[model samples]
Target: MKKFRYIVCLLSLATLSSCDSILDKGPLDAFTNDNFWTGEGNVSGYANTFYEQFLGYGNAGGSGDFYFNSLSDDQVGRDFDQYPNNKGVPSSSTTWRNGWIEVRRANIMIEKVSQMTTLDDAARNHWLGVARLMRAWQYYKLVRMYGNVQWVEKSLDITDEGVLYGARDDRDMVMDRVLDDLNFATQNVKDVASKTTWNRSMANAMKAEVCLYEGTFRKYRKSEDSQKAPDGAGATKFLTACKEACAAVMAKGYSLNTSYQGNYNSIDLSKNPEMILYKAYKEGLLMHSLIAYICSSTQISGMSKNAFESYLFTDGKPLALTALNKTDKAPMVDGHLSLKDILAVRDKRLSQTIDGVLLYNGRGYTRYNVGMESTASSGYGICKYDNPAIPEGFRNNTTKNYTHAPLFWLSVVYLNYAEACAELGAITNDDLNKSINLLKDRAGLPRITTAIGFSDPANNHGVSDLIWEIRRERRCELMFDNNVRYWDLVRWHQLDKLDNSKNPDILRGANVANDMSGCKADKVGEYIDGSKASIRAYDKKYYLYPIPSGQIALNPQLAPNNPGWE
Candidate 1:
């Protein structure tokens, strides 16, 4: 409870009559109505609090629940129930509740920073730009989730009777407000070189992301006879804007990480080239708790049953029915695959995401060291953030921790560019070539096509084919970046199109007898477990998570519960 108190403090919602003096200097200090607007650093620090909130929810809990496996082809956990369950989610509320709180804080910073005479025009403008940008980011998440929501431009006092009873805003009104904030941010924000932290680039990236989503969502939302198709003229304009925004950062010299493992496996800031706007975790933040909580007690993290069955074999079954194939000679199961043979050609990212090797002892993984359970039993303990240098005997329950998680990375920008080009019908060979080559070449994989079996830049594909390729790339490249998986399905409205089976059928029947041996009285058994078979089945209603029942009773205007929940 004390840990979550930091969130309240950052939002200025703490019971401020007491404990104010002790936490005043800390980042979690409550913003009293009286002394809230003081110095430039205080304003900036308050703005930083909003960023901290985003890091807390978007990447930490949201990513684990939705991004990692819920929307992926991995196993889905059985104990889960949410909206878009079996294709119908309610329209009453949204998944992101605190987004508005962050927006309000950013607006407060924007308003107060303008009056800080102690800071020069240049510094003040820069800080204001960041505040506006952060506010836009908050709105972006809102608009993406629930089309039209109430838009609030100014920061409201929670204690204000008017604020506590405010109603939801129209969707288009929110977009206009987001655009207005972004326009200000884009013009006043200094170039990437001038900024030190991820503040400015993220602001710029938010503009691109919002424009792309609005353009695409608008195109898709309208009726077929309503003068807008999926590839309409409005979509074209928005795609152009996305291209320009992403290009600006690329011009500023942001590039992909050369090695996939290094990008996620290690937590050092110097080596991380892909993260544009991420929250940096220090020792006390315990941002690591979110990661460690999902893994095994011996390792780290505990995966929910809904998240456990998201992965599948090419045949679309869970791991119980499918076996991990070592050779590429068998019949291609899921044809039109992203790569020629996915099992044999494991993506470079797989190593970074899973603990395929044992970590109990300080030694490399061997064939017989069956200490850790696979994705089925342990719910896919994502090892991407684990630091191998931590002493092997040190249990994750105590010493192990993750320092940071990127809220928005450069890879998404590339994806935005790819999607926009596909919508525009201007997806040239050069575009696909550059996009896929940049991603694949960096990861040491062969970019294969129908004409060229692998890495032949001469073989260029059509826009449709490249779109599928890009989606696959994004799935593999940006796994667990945020709550991207669930939202991706929502944006495309493809949640219903998904086949919700539980297990991987491919690895189930393969030569696994050698891989199933047990060690010393079943202490180190690699044998297949019965639980893996149970996770292979799918439930349609697991799409949008339930809006907490308590929230529904709080406001009658907020609409009813999602489809699957009673």
Candidate 2:
């Protein structure tokens, strides 16, 4: 029998009756809120409830985190003109509701854990750290979306309406509190044996991520309001914190997996050295459709032409500056390079991430190729999460596909460390070797040194040559995983890259003229539902999402919706 874990416990808890008897008079045998706080097991079980919410590979049949960047410059979806462009002011948002819900849950856990007198100091501190970590995670997300969110440390009742409907706190104030929580988590969260559970390393990783975001956001954002930081706490302070946190994780003995492709397309990552935390999916108990989505003949979205071209050549030089691109013109076919040729000279990760050849019905590695299947919108199919080893039956069934999802990994920490160093303006070649060069070595590219003085002409972000290269490496390494690209753009204050009018490359897809037979010679871009891919005009207001209209109405303090929306 498979060992029942957090996910199983969560599923079992969901099926329980919500009757008054069960609510008021908690069952003696089963764990309830009233009885659950008595032991470590129950406290751990409660913490498990947050795992699915924060870490799990999304719903079985959904796109999961793979398509999160569809709204950003990295990838273009079938609905190209969706969010950040056509986003509307809603009355309420699940993002707002669910965030507060999770925050309350974390606060409740902290309160309950504190009340437990039986637990030893170590155990109590561990559980408290877990709760604080969770709270910080939610707040970090909330702050990212809404600039100045209300900071609630404790659970509030209806009687505490003043606290509930209080004015939005300063971003710096909330982030400082978030930093405090992360510090507590990093110091107190035990180093657990289970890779799936939260540990001290994971806490440090989370802190690094949070600090980098805030630090860069403050440094890059032009808005005076957005740049505000608490006394003695600004970009330098947070970035230093980010650097130290990353260094803490680096000392924990994590390394990159042998194959870059194996990181994403794995069934078992429990023992993978790169993984700090991963969501385990059993064959029968819990599975996801991400692998099936990649393997199936379904018309998935593709990376943007800009994203595809961002990968550095094998020589660690951008295409414009690479001699290989100038010398070898054979790859060029009908004004665009063939998919095979494109993947050949660029970073090895390109081939691992995207299909090297056009795959359609009765073609390529797909097993269940129904005639109704269509090619990806961009003609550049995403193969990052594809696993060819799974049997035919399993690939076709959404729920049966059992690929593990990496929630946190060492590569991200490496990127975090490198970027933090670069942003701090004190990066050394030794720092590059310790962080970015390791990733370069894994990607089979020439090692980058601090003396890389040449700048890519594509440096539209106005960053230094080193910073630009670091950002590119980050983009390539973390593509199609989570919303890294989107958030990176946001923090760097470069969302204008999404403007199709300004950056036409973002809307362009694969060069399908040569390989895809029926594709028009003139129309080289991805077509969706008989229309070419496009994005609406970009606005500065898109930097921060609008606080829901209803939320503003209820509080009035949240008036003046995010910049352009007003």
Candidate 3:
């Protein structure tokens, strides 16, 4: 796969600037339009650029998708809360702009793949599948952000005026096209032996994810903006698609990695059966600072109280109703449950995610105090991506850590299967056995059956007991990975959970003792609070991001910017 690294550089010379430009030109020095598509290797090399563009682990000084939960209810930053405030509208958006650039690149590949006369039928279809898959991924991102974006299937020339300045397509219509591309990819893409590259299994994984999102988004989000499916059969159609996609991936013989912690903290996932697709990082060639972000003394962010309490006890019950609550019996540290005691009664994954020993400024601290020097915003230290075996010198340095990042895995597929079944009101004990129970087994907890009679007092999302449990499993399993929590809230139409005025738990952290140094005695034994001003009250318009004002100005057909941004 190291060849992909160099191929991306070579392909960049042929990449177009945007979708609205004339795409007839080719690289002058390296290759021309006539010669680049002459071989299968060049086609594969052209597709290699999408890997770096779409599935990057992290750059030198940034934690890529690992900490994206900061924008959701799972975590909060130290300087301020991580909620989006009412900033009116933006003049332009790089996400909106860069998305078109990649879309154009993918469209060019799709068009050029048909011109590869030397390749066999199998080879040509494989390249076309790869190109369509990349295009679908970019459009999915666009739809997730700005609801109704123009669906451009081909690389448009400057003479194409209607598509360049046209009204945005309906959400369901564009998603159906995305679904078509995904179906094509799943059928035509060969199953590559390498885990890092795109394949039939990866396409299935992505299809399951995209369908589940669209299904739930339609079921929960209500509006009159023509986002609904035309035939009024939106939720069931996409949820069924999600279910079938999951089943296809499950049949591929992928299993959970025995060590739950090893999934994220591993240096090499090349042979891990759990990983369907991952971003490979070499020690010196491609490394990231995610481990440094986790292990450093810098005040990044930490898990929120809302997220911490979502993990169920070993008996598979919420902490409020569980008999296994150890707050009274466990040893007290600074008037709070000791980290060890907290780990004793709760799910094992919690211990794996957060460090048990408190550290301040890279030194051990016995007291679990909030607002300390090295403690995160919520006082809970995140260690999910930390490899403890790495030397302190390298772990603290930027771009030095090389832990592989999981992009798509079997656990997520399992969760998606369970959720799709539950959402379609077709889940059963058999579904539980095959999906959520496997995760429960890995966490060393009791298996859940459909006969759950107890209702969690903490469940305020208005879902049934079984569906809530399945959602909880997803939250715990995918804690800080790749903005899953935030998008989950969005697709469920539950962004109101981030409002601290109604849900104060989002602003609270670990309880502190009066005697702990630097602790505010008056606020001791109470929720460690964040500033209220940091969170914006939820608005109905927040469901879809506002389209760029500059774009709407350029093309008046994109008027009436999202719901309330007008």
Output the number of the TM-score-best candidate: 3
lDDT of 2 at 11: 30
- Evaluated at residue 401, the lDDT of candidate 1 is 49
For each candidate in turn, the TM-score is: 0.69, 0.89, 0.90
Compose the digit string of candidate 1's lDDT tens values, residues 1-566.
44234335645552232224434776664655556666665555555554444543223223432223443333233223223334334333434556666666676667777777788887788888888887788777766654445577676553543443345565556766777777778777765542236355776677888877766665554332122235456566666777777766666567777766555544555557776765555553543444333344442222322222223334322334444553422222222111234333355565455544322111112112222322322223456655545433321433344445556667778777777776666776666565655776655565534232222121122224445456556666766656565556555544433443422321121112222232111111332222333232334334334445444454434444433454
Ranking by TM-score: 3, 2, 1
Clashes (backbone N, CA, C under 3 Å), per candidate, total 50, 0, 0
- Pairs in steric clash, model 3: none
- Residue 479's lDDT within candidate 1 is 63
Model 3 misplacement above 4 A: 1-28, 224-232, 326-337, 358-373, 514-525
Question: How many Å off is the CA of 348 in candidate 2?
Answer: 0.8
Global lDDT for candidate 1? 0.50
Q: Quick one: ranking by lDDT, best first? A: 3, 2, 1
Local accuracy of candidate 2 as per-residue lDDT tens digits, 1-566: 12224324433433232112333345556655676677787677677777756545566665566554477777767555555525588888878877877888788889999999889999999999999998999999998988888898776654466766688888778999999999999999998756888799999999999999988987887854354432324888899999999999998889899999898879999889999998887787877777656555565676777887799898778878887763222233443334666567888998899866653222233323432243565556687876767776776677777878888899999999999999999999999999989999989899988878698999999989999999999999999888888889888888777777777778666554333444532243332121253446766667778889877776676677766665
Error of 1 at 547 (Å): 7.2
User: Worst 10-residue stretch by lDDT in candidate 1?
Assistant: 515-524
